[model samples]
Target chain A: MTSESDRSRRDVLILGAATALVGAGLAGPAAAELKTVVYNNSGGASADAARAAWGGLMRDRASSNLLVTAPASVARLKAMIQARNVEWDVAELVSQEHKQAIRESMLQKLDLSVIDLSHTPDDCKDEYSVVYALYSTAMAYSSKIAAAKRPGSWAEFWDVAKFPGRRALRNHPVDNLEFALLADGVPKDKIYPIDFDRAFASLDRIKKHIAVWWRDGSQPAQMLIDGEVDFTSGWHGRFFALAQKGETGFGVQWNQAMLKRSWVGVPQGAKNPREAMQLISFMIDPTASAKYAEGIGYICCDARANNHLPENVRPWVMSNPAIAELTVSANEQWWLDNGELAQRKWNDWIVT
Target chain B: MVRRWFWIPGLGFLVLFFLLPVGAFLLQSVLDPGPTFMHFERLFEGRAFWVSLGNTFRISITVTLICAVIGFLIALRIATLQRPYANALLVLIVMTVWISLLVRNYAWMVLLGREGIISTSLVALGIFERKTSLLFNEAAVVLGMVHVLIPYMIIPTYAAVQAIDPALLRACDSLGARPAQVFSRVLLPLSLPGLATGCLLVFTLSLGFYVTPAILGGRGQTTLTMLMEIEVNEQLNWGFAAAHAAVLIAITAVLFFAYRSKFGMDRLWGQEL
Candidate 1:
């Protein structure tokens, strides 16, 4: 309890009033309907989107409201579940995280009847979650970089002699495996059921030239902007954001753009699970999704969401379905099954 | 009757805020999902674990030594200043703590980045033909940690320095002791507790550092905190994370007792250092 008696009693009163308000009638009063709902995310761009596009839009319309938080971790989720005290009403999860949460029964099952998934991509939807936004693990290079030519494929990315500059990539093996396979001459269509031997071999080729094995989505972009690395494979939005600011000499090669997806799942035993599920459905609305994508520079998984955006604006936004079709969707299940092994291998590979 | 029971609130604070939660965490490290010691086993099983542990101690000690040497001079300067000047120096030192850790790390990035201010300024002055990679190096990591943790060291040492009797300094001066002799023989020995306290504070605080190393340091700079983060955040291995945390706790506990034997426990008490 707080040292201040006023605050301690007020917290108790708020709890009592919230319960009484819920018990009175589910949809009785606008002010009382959602006394509290804690929405958790991985923070940064995603949190900003929820605050502006979703929370800002629904502030006047809905009785329920969201209080945003930063960087949800499964460890925290498990600890809360074990203590029988859940804080997050709605938690943003990756595809594999959604799977793990489902296995642990750490998330509530969704009711599709309430959620109109007509606009949401079928492959994107999950048992306990709704898809949020899409990004890419694509090639980034400085046009001003000294080389015979720029790298357009993973094979060329491995060729340090031609590139002749330091490079940056994520520290994880999720997309790196696929990129390595592609670099080893595996066709884009036939990249799955990955040949591990060849992939690691492909990695060993360029591993020495990699100046930085960045961990965050934005680090590689920042490195490229700072000229710490001549090339990198990072989130397209990172370089795109820089480009829109009139920063020159940067180019993106989206040929092998691998789609990265995010989802929103209700944590099991949340105080407002029903309200959280409803909010998920509400956010899947095309206008909200597009406004979210526009504000955050991520692609909305719902194709129709971009229809709300002007055609000229879509070019700058990377919201085009044509480019989406060309880009390959990451096999989340493959990673989910082999993730620990791959991650261990990645850790050993980098450290040594 | 209740006047002597003032310690109840303090005891309540420790039990409610510290003991119960830490007890749960340690218990879970051994017995989450099912009763097991596999989490503890995991701590010793990997090369990554050993590497992270080694790096954490290495970086923290390096930061501690740097902080101790520089911070003592700062404290000594502040302690010997005129009243207004001493207050002004302290305010300047304390002002840095007001800025959040993340902003400070980002500021370091902007200054030390390849295209950052220092590099650009140097390049403009014809120092180099091309930009050099300055950030994401060991030097940057140490620089960032020292900048953030020095204040922790300075505050306690400053307190210790201020508490020394001015009459002792005057007595040494009256005995015809030179300034250097006065400091080395009298002030230095007297200020040992503060120096010890400051070093301990900076050393312990640096062990849990995350954002600075994560932002300013790259692959080679990865510490135990980052490794635990990988286990907890990326791998979702809380059992292993808890075990790793237990290792840190056990190490800190041993150090706590070690420091207690050398300098009384009263100094480390009440500060949460």
Candidate 2:
């Protein structure tokens, strides 16, 4: 027992020394003791884009620092909220989730006094969150096959006979319900508080032709590249990236795109709330947001950033004026309130 | 000099790694957000869980049946071959087992898709007027599941076949017993245990499948795991998700109990009946 306890103590000592060495390597006289804030967002390509944008710029300011992290999932966030042990200073939440956060009071109201809002739009900055990226779920089709009979809108997407082939759609009701409503001749502005009966009826028409119900943001793009299905609806960035690199032959239909904004929110009792707020303020800087948007194919609301982007990349991003005009903003609050009911209906509809 | 207390470490590992998490889930399903039956009640009251559960049973049974037939044949072929040839073929079969399930499923998606090699080739050969997709169908899901499970079926059956006495076959031939008689009376009885093992393994594994069906399954082809995921992730209905999980556990347990009652639990672990 004595030997085993001694070994554990030695192990702890070694671990402590290694950590101290790593910290010594990072620390310098010039490196001010900036309170480190873990900026939690969806990891992968978007995280890279975010790092390029706000990460370096904030670090340059030498104010409170930030470290980018992956997926602060709702479950984890809720647990932290309940326990009063907020791990992340800033969390990137989607539209409905952002609204859900506010509704649950999991997040503290942002101090707009610290964050500059002159360039950021009214809709982009709420009390709880500041919009980081506008991810558009748009109609993406096989560029090779969709040309002659391309689906210009959700209506055309459902027209299997005109452009007869298989399709992959997101399994959820979030955007698909809106697309169904739109295809059924519901106006873009009137999509929210979704007409459930009508929407499901519309979805039923094209149900037989759907070849895949894509679960991931990346799946639809690969499906298009592999020619798994002739048509699918997915995140705009994937289709944009495919087009940019000429990696896969694919086309995007921006018309009636369900554009939803992803936001960075401060947890209610974060250790570094001030730093988190300042980091969010710096993130909304027009030039940096533009760079972030260009690097990733998401759209930022700052109009000033649009002119700085290269011409070829403009058409792919939501920053493109033409593409912007084509998109319809989904109601975040409505989704927050009605998401559960919609899912229940969706579950029944999907099985049938 | 090894004591019975030596087993404590392994038991502790199982308790820590397996039992605790599953026990937490079992507890959480009932106790979380206050104890209520609404979540489990939703299963019978709603069409989603029933449909998903139905699909799970159908897909698992079908895959198990196909694996049983093909796996037994392959084992028989390998057993009848020369020792070196049998070893080479066994190596080939085992090599496929090393490949990731996702990679295998994705390969099937590529081969069976609309503009895939088979579909395009068939169209080129004037077999069809337009390009067609073979993916996102029940057949594709079954085929993918069967492909993944066949190796599991083969190894056990081969072991059983390999253990068969060759002198018995010579005696049967000398006694003027027909080839069919020898196969039915001797080989069939010997191999039944292995075939049963393969069927149970394949069916149970196929029941829990989420990835292959998620990637390949279409609108109506959704399974219980997929439904459970949506409940957890999308709805954030932990209680409901737990209920679905409990259902899965219950089904697996029921199947296992039935098997154990018939064959005895010892056979399931290693011993052949």
Candidate 3:
């Protein structure tokens, strides 16, 4: 035990000496910069876009000290928060996650005072989260079945007689349940207190038609490419990515689509909470948000950002007003209250 | 004495990497933040658990049976062949084993999908008026598992069949026993040890298979692994996931012991197995 204590003391002495050496080795006093890490699940192109926007903004700011880092998974972010080693100053969370995180007291409350909100959408700014990305879970159909018309709404999507072929749905219960409920003739406004029995009954009606229940965003898209099924529910951004490569083999309709927002939150026990708040403030800036949307094919509700976008890409990034009006916005607070019951019902319904 | 020092590092690695994580996860099965069995009770009550457990066992048994028949034949061929042919056959079996399971499953998917080569050809031949897809179904899952597991069956059967003395077969021939009699009486009993080992290996693997069933199987065809994944990733219920996994592990262990005694594979296979 004495030897162990002595060894630790020697190690501490060495660490202190190393720190002193590093302090002495500096060429000059460095500028005071707040280094903040951002946890993001969108790793490939979206992360690059986030980094690019922040890199320029950080370079120009004299007193504005900020650094952003993006980690990949919510499970990892949850671990960091639980351990109180929250390296993420700001994190991108899905709507359900944002709601759950807030309920769990995992996030620090957002102070809107630090942010410029003159051009921000009222829906985007919130007490606990700021909308980072907006995408749609919409309908898509294969063009291979030449006789079948494109499904424009949930009702039409469910009209197997008119659009006859095998169908696909995501493995998750969230959007699919909503769509099924909608097809069962539940009004969009009343979707909140979901009539559980009716919703599941509606799901059962079309269960046999569904040939593939995909796990990831990419799976539905891959299924379309693979011709695994004739029609499916899909994300618009993924379809847009495919459409950009000339003529897409499948088509998507924005009618009755569900719009989901990804939000950024700072953990309550972040390693650098102040730095994280600064990064969050920067993220809401119209210019930065616009650039991110442009690169990632997602919508950010900075009105200024939408106005500044390249004309060709703007329509794709922000849902056209006509298209946007047709879709229902997910009520995350409702989900927070009802998720457990809904998840249980979903599991039992699927098994049955 | 030298091995004792080596064992310290080896045992340390096992305890740190394997035992610690497993122990922690197993503890999570019973002990939640509030110290309750809520998660396990929830899992047991859910129909998904029972359905997927049944499906997992059903697939494992089916795959094991198919593997035994096909692998036994292949191993018999290899054992009876000349040296060069036997070497080539062994290399082929190893090659199949070496290929990635994901790659093999994807290949099967391509063959079975709507616009896949098979479907296209069938359509062209007027075998069907429209393209028929078989991508996500129980059949595809079983076919993929069988293809992947054949090598497991083959290796053991080959080793077991090879162990039977040539002189035994010669003695049977001298006694005017037919080839069929020799195969049933002499060869089949001698190779039973290997067949038993291979079936168990394939069966255990199919029970735990996640990726194959997830990619290939459709609704009502999902397995225990998929259910466990849904619990962990979608529901974020690690406790329930752990309990389900523990149940699967326990079941597999029980089966292993039962099979070991019934077939005497415990003696025939190596100690590590």
What's the TM-score of each model vs. the native? Answer: 0.86, 0.86, 0.84
DockQ for model 2 equals 0.18
lDDT of 3 at B58: 88
Instruction: DockQ winner between 2 and 3, please give it.
Output: 2
lDDT of 1 by residue, B182-238 (tens): 889987887778789878878888888888788888777778788778877888777
True lDDT of residue B147, candidate 1: 92
Leading candidate by lDDT: 2
Better of 1 and 3 by DockQ: 1
Tens-digit lDDT string for candidate 3 (A137-218): 8888777767447676788778898877778898777888789889988899889777777888898888877878886676
Q: Which pairs clash in model 3? A: A38-A69
Q: Taking the tens digit of each residue's C-alpha lDDT, what string does model 2 give over A228-279?
A: 7778999887776666666767777889998888888899878888788878
Encode model 1's per-residue lDDT on A164-203: one tens digit a residue: 7788888888899999998888888898777777888889
Select the stronger candidate by lDDT from 1 and 2: 2
lDDT values for all models:
0.75, 0.79, 0.74
Q: iRMS of every model, one decimal?
A: 12.9, 15.5, 19.1
